[model samples]
Target: GKTHLASALGYKACQEGIETRFWRVSDLVLELEKAWKENQLERFKKKFNRVQLIILDEMGYVPFNKNGSELLFQLISDWYETKSIIITSNLEFSSWNKVFIDPRLTSALVDRLIHHAHILTFTGESYRLKNALSKIE
Candidate 1:
């Protein structure tokens, strides 16, 4: 549901000629890992730097190893205050350590993300399930 909303916003941004990009957290980490292996990490970072808005979907669905976590942190840090990021995560702020592993790094990442940010929480049954049931009825 949150991913749907975020993607809609990204689409609207694109329609308005704003530079927008969307990536699932796991895929983004994998891309970063590949970039690091190919020694093109800087190029990867530069590619996203100019985006006006980035939607990071499905955070906390997969936990990151230390290296992947650091890479994600670096990406977030780079985008901090420069570009808008809409992150859709099922995990609460307290559970973020489960994903990042390091408490301090998680804290720092949360701090950077929450600064000058608007957070929206969605509660209730899965929208996809609800839609499926409605169609059957």
Candidate 2:
């Protein structure tokens, strides 16, 4: 539902003709890794040059390799203060290091991401869990 709501915002931006990009965090990292291995990282990174907003979903859902961490750091740094980014993460900021391969990179990336960023934290029992319990009761 969170993702759906975020997606609606992205869709509404698209309706207004904003150049937007939506990506799953893991898949985005995989693509970056692929671009690096193919020696086309610059070209791949430039693909976002015309985009105004980027929605990165499901962060912390999987672990990132060193290269993925580096690539993501570089990308986020490039977008810092220049573009809009919305990230949905399952892990708290304090535990981001668990998903990233390098501690220093994680710190730098988190700093860049949180600069002038609006954070909305999800809390309490999961809706699915509540519904399931009610069904059995």
Please provide, for model 1 over 1-137, each residue's C-alpha lDDT reduced to its tens digit, 9 standing for 90 to 100: 89889999999999999999999999999999999989999999989766999999999999999999999999899898899899999999999999999999999999999999899999999988999999999
**Candidate 2: residue pairs that collide:** none
lDDT value for model 1:
0.94
TM-score for candidate 1:
0.93
Compute the lDDT of residue 112 as modeled in candidate 2. 89
lDDT of 2 by residue, 1-137 (tens): 56887899899999999999999999999999999999999999889989999999988999997878888889989998898998887789889998987888889989988888888878888788899999999
- Taking every candidate in turn, the Cα RMSD to the unseen true structure, in Å, is 1.9, 1.6
Q: Once all C-alphas are superposed, what RMSD does model 1 give against the true structure? A: 1.9
